[model samples]
Target: MSATTLTVRQQLVYEKELCERSFKDFIRLAWPHVDTAEYKHNWHVDVLAEHLQACTDGRITRLLINICPGSAKSLIVNVLFPAWLWAIRPKTRVLSASHSFDLATRDSLKTRRLITSEWFQRRWPIGLRNDQDAKTKFENDSFGAREATPLKSITGNRANFVIIDDPHSVDDAKSAAMRATAVETYLTAVPSRLNDPDRDVIICVMQRLHEGDVSGAILGRPDLDYDHLCIPLFADGVDRPPTSIGWIDPREEGENMFPARYTEKVVRGYRASLGPLQFSGQYQQAPAPDADGFFRREWFHRYEPSALPQHVNYYMTSDHAPSGNNDYNVFRIWAVDHNRALWLVDSFRKRCTMDIALGLSRDANAKTVIAPEGAFALIRKYKPRAWFPENDGTWAAIKSMVSAAMIETKTFVTIDPLPTKGSGDKVGKAVGYQAMAAMGQVHLPVGPIGDEALSEYAMFPAGKRDDQVDADSAIARALEDVIPAWLPIIAPKKKRSMFDDDDSRATSDDCWG
Candidate 1:
């Protein structure tokens, strides 16, 4: 028997083993040396049991499950997993790969010790003449050993079952490159060892890290097949009917989680440690803008009587919405003449297709049209090249475009050029976001033509669908680049000379205080 299992009080662990299909016996049978939490999830165990049975019956093999942390992942794969395998196919050769060799050996040794324990041996004893080799050729003629090595170093498995336990660590989850390394090594090196036709039934469990992590690489390639599951709260990733699934509720459905009295406990931690976004991401799982502090309301408001021209070239940008789900791209053409005055002109928007946008542009007779590159492909058959940033994708283009639209309303206040004064980085960001919140107050023209833009500009429903704002952005960007003189500048007032008091000497005989 291994040292760890001897430490466990049988009175505590074995009490309920006879009552139910004791999972403790399963743990004790597979891994007697190590102690980890164990629980039987009826749904998850059933899926695992069926899959494992298929492997032994020569029907199906090779499986993968992706799950989040804190979902009893270790107990499922680490302890009860090996015991279940041992119970099925006799002397089944198994190889397990994890992120590290030490972690691998620790898990292997624990299982090894369990199979060698008195209780486990009583159930399925290891009886072999060549005991010195540590290989107990079981009654079923199947035998397996544990070896923890780098993913690149698996020489020969000659095993039937293989389990990979999170080959990537938390740090690997962060970096796309590191995750790729772990995945590449596993695919190339580890599987070469198996000898049987049913080679190895491999199962991998890990958290969803980046989009390009090991799980992603394995999943993206058509060479391998995987049943994908994504559940943050549950231990298993198998998609179930939503009628009885999703976030867990402690009380009755719709009953208040919070009573009337404000304890100020949860609010205190929210305010103290993190910014608004950190709370949203860590607690609410909502992603926020990566760049919030750099842009400003005052920077947007460069409008002046001189800033306008008499019937030159100008445009009205609006992010319109047909429904609450997505916004419609809308914009109006304009002109500022040499006399420094403005004139609003034609408008453009469509519920469905660029056919409407093309007709609008052609009717307006605009040569240098500025629009999102995504919408560029549609109308280019008629108009000149619709200009967009040289390097940007659809999503980023949408965000910048919306910020540009808010500038046209003249709701923000600024002088000529942008102001950069007495402040460090933190103070500057605080000031910038403050200005942005203030800019939210501006209301676009409320006509039927502008109704879509106003509603979308207000909330931009569903937190996505920014194409409407993209159309508006095209207008704002064109103006900012063409007329640099239109940018606003906030100047500081001169300080008062309070030191020139009667008692305060400030003459030829200056007082050196």
Candidate 2:
């Protein structure tokens, strides 16, 4: 029935039920300012709404959404979703955070405005506590509250739904220290605030930034089991698969995801202005190109786990970082085959203090001692021929610590300090590593860690973290001359003309030396 045909109480109940049943309807009812002519609501909106509705139904406890900016992501998720939650699930508390406090407060204010709007109250009858009405935080009469904060510790605040919107700013994403801080906040600070850890949901929505950004960290970890909803600006037909919610990008290949909003012309302009790297991350939802960069992804050859040779020479190379820095200590095991191809056997990386990095043994009791495993376990397992530690400021201190620990544990292994190289020289070494991989002389063991190493290589000099790449560069420098001079370069056979003679044939010496 139309609004005019219904009784006063009947109309109220009808509107309330309509808003609760359809979040899209609720947006239209609550916000009269949306210009349909310019807004051009697309199919992706319904897809997003469906996934969010699924969140409330407890089907998804963790969600990470990567979408191009200006797709109304913040408006749909940050502003509308929270207020809709209050309408249906009246006592659901929400904790929202952004990279900056001002940004968080802005969304909070919009949500507050929606909740207090005449249309919203007429239907849902939810009221905000008079004394608790604030921009950053507010409490409803039903005991549900919405609190917004910068990406930092939210002391004593608890919530049923934790939402992180754009946790890393563009500039902050380029800095390893800042990216680490953002990831730490997401990993350590926010998860604990959930009122119901098992039942409550956490949603993170942002454009990808770096390989170590929060989105990257979430996707890399399989234990989290996040439901990822990626909406790139252009449809590659496979960027978004069929989600459990039965919503997928329906656009064909080469079509714009939201053509009316981000047209072909606009997208082309973005590509030209943002450059390949930024445009790929921000618009394509992929931080690095698959086959382009200083280190091409296709060049990192993979080997079957079962095909590994038993008797190959092994060596360990490391990249170290002192405490208080965000860098990770990387330990990599490399195997050199008889053909001199370098195989990445194993790797371990962690952001830890010197004690943990070294795996120092400590006294547990009067008769008991506990030996933590870090690099020590890898050394014991692989028994590498030598350990090459980068010759940086921390080299001497690390060598001293390793020596003292070895003497105590009676585990003797050769320790060699890598030749000191300046920051500019490391890039050149990375180029050498890239060249080695391109020549098929570098092989990677097939696994998730290997995939991660390849991505790091592909985004080298542009990625936030480079500890893995640095270790690979160290190994490349040490094994630069391992390729045998006797190895034959087989060139394609050239069809001989009747007039051609043996003297015109190319010799093996004419190949690349």
Candidate 3:
């Protein structure tokens, strides 16, 4: 060969070596039609590639990578990284699994294609063994094997490198049993699949699904000791991994992780499509299911106590649960104006003995106290002008209990059972209140108490403590009876033409006269 040809061949060999040593470079060279061929290089992909390199070098034994959906996580972690591993160490064994067998097989086919590609074969020369050549499971001549299996079907397989792409699907993640099963498999079956317990590599790549999902289960377990790389879709200014881990986020606050692929408009579209809770979990990687759904914070209207109209009727509503491991006893004082706008004045909620609960009720000092069937006894001691107990077929018993309590305390207070109306369910009542609140018909005093109430409203059915919501809903239900009289009806103003006399614009009082 000529001198120029020899130099070109040497440079080509140098480039081949670079590709062999680097996972990203190997991806570019082997799958030029995929990674860098048409797609712009993303920093998150580089980060994932570097982390996988660390895993390959035995710097990290157990790794957990959480990235948003459509961030090319599976393409990088499952397809490129495994193929790159085999390029350098043909003897390395890899066990790849996903939520489903089809997904695992799809990735397996991609990796197989990369391994069998002309570029990869020419550069690395790791030929697949003739006996073990298959789509889902393939072995190289150097005793290395890559097996693709469903997450639940990995019974007696072992590998040096185990890659679980997404152990739970979106639907599977929603189910507690499915999440538990995935975690159990990860804890029990997956660990046993390690050819060497101490030295084998296990990398889990997935989006945040739920608090009880496999990723959560693994992270919660300190004994497992996984190096977590959480790449949220948006940069939220919260430092996820400690600086000691050397995983610095490249994006600034509010910047998209992969803006090249998903534009700001596209991200917003996703947010609109997924809703807040799903978007928070799947995209932002914040699996706070309680914080996002049911009631949005913006829907609430906060006002000063002075904003209450002068002729407002003040009342208190209660949802009672007895002490000793029951739901909290809650009382919310409210005022309804002539315009039928409901204003939350004051509130108290806690798990207390009946004595303290009664003390709380008296301390409220409202004109009327509306209690549920369970709270009639405790609330009667407050001597409210009108005591309305929620009557759901147990009115007589509730009345008897209130009368007995009044007799015992030597104080008589009028008791009236509130008839069940308009789809009598807690959630239904809450939904009604939510509609009113959304229309700016409900207002809350701006303070800590209001903040607490709004927090409960925001959490709703998903929250751990919903006593505040119950109290609010009860008050809303009570207001349905009171608001008809309170709702203002303004007389229609008479219209006048420009040519009409000034007397035509006179007030309705003048017309009545």
lDDT of 3 by residue, 1-513 (tens): 444666755766876788777877765555573455466677876788788888877789999988888877898889988888887888899999999989999999988988887766666788888999999999998999999999999877799999999999999986667888899998999989998999999999999877677888888897988998888887878766642248777778878787688898898898789877778778877675444576767767888877777766555676666552657767656677776778876665667764455442332554233343224433443333444456654344345555655655465645444566655566776776777777788888898988888766654553446777766776666666643525354689978678988676367688777
What lDDT score belongs to each candidate, Candidate 1 first?
A: 0.44, 0.81, 0.74
Quick one: RMSD of model 1?
14.2
**What is the number of backbone collisions in each predicted candidate, taken in the order shown?**
21, 0, 0
Q: After superposition, how far is residue 341 of candidate 3 from its true place, in Å?
A: 5.8
Model 2: per-residue Cα lDDT at residue 129:
91
Range of the 10 consecutive residues with the lowest summed lDDT in candidate 2: 480-489
Q: Which segments of model 1 are wrong by more than 4 Å?
A: 1-33, 36-54, 58-60, 127-142, 197-199, 229-231, 234-513
RMSD of 3: 8.4
Q: Residues 1-513, candidate 2: write the lDDT tens digits.
A: 567899988988987898899988776666563223345567888778888888999888899999989988998899999999999988999999999989999999989888887777787778889898899999998899999999875657999999999999999998879998889879888889899899999999999887789998998897988888988787756655555666677667767787777877887898788877888889888787554557777776788988787658788888888782688988898887777778899877889887777666577553222244567777877888778788789888778778877777667678777777553565776777778888878889888779889867767766766899998888776665333312343589978799976666376675554
Task: RMSD for all candidates, in order, please.
Answer: 14.2, 9.2, 8.4
Best by TM-score: 3
Ranked by TM-score from best down, the candidates are 3, 2, 1
Selected candidate, larger lDDT, 1 vs 2 = 2
lDDT leader: 2
Between prediction 1 and prediction 3, the one with superior TM-score is 3
How much does candidate 1 score in TM-score? 0.47
